[model samples]
Target: MAIIHYFAPMMKMRIFGLVFLGMAAACYNPPRNCNDFKEGEFRFTTVVGENEQTTTFIRRKSIEIDYYQEKADTSSIRWINDCEYVVKKINPKTPAEEKSIHMKILSTTDSSYTFEYGLVGSSKKSRGTAFKVN
Candidate 1:
């Protein structure tokens, strides 16, 4: 009976510790500077086919022009909020490219923002961090 009493308090303490740790982890938050990223020249680097590829884009009020792999394409931007927008290829060459991409800024730093984007209405998402170049 005495050993059972001692173990009961120990179990409670362990459970309480776990709960406190969970709460502390939940409190962590990332930074965002949506307005600063709204209009700028930015660079994004991603791994493609085992090679690091970089793309540059200039975003204005409602349009974005991207230069990638020696090709330039224009896209239209529709802002849903300060930190979210949808982008569609201005002149899509294929049906797949006609899908609009939904982008949300998840976090930001002094000169960059981490974002997640996917085709609108799709469940799969891709994340990337973009840095302001100018």
Candidate 2:
């Protein structure tokens, strides 16, 4: 009887903790309206060897045009879904450029999105954020 009395309070605390966690989990929802970003003019900035580089791109239904380093490059887009897509350069100049890149939209805001990108068929991924320009 004494053992039961001592454990009762601990069991009640464990039950309360679980119920609180469940409620918190049920109330949280992540923003993922990916279609809002499917077609837009956006800018992405990254650091390259101490130099800040920016790429501006315009995406349409099945195509994207990127402006970087005073050059415009066009790529064909194959969307796996609303949040995932593959991009292949239309006129790749080198062997490295010939590889396709896989991109996934990880999260979004009112005028920007965070994304993960990597070479197609590769396990490595890098993340970046792009802000809408239009």
Backbone clashes in candidate 2 total 0
In candidate 1, what are the lDDT values of residues 2-31, reduced to their tens digit?
999989999999999999999999998898
Over 1-134, each residue of candidate 2 has an lDDT whose tens digit, in order, gives 99999999999999999999999999886687899999999999999899999999999999999999999999999999999999999999999999999999988999999999999999999999999999
- Pick by TM-score: which candidate is best? 2
Candidate 2 residue spans exceeding 4 A from truth: 1-7, 15-29
Among these predicted structures, which one has the highest lDDT? 1
Q: Would you give me the overall lDDT of model 1?
A: 0.97
Superposition TM-score, candidate 2 onto the true structure: 0.86
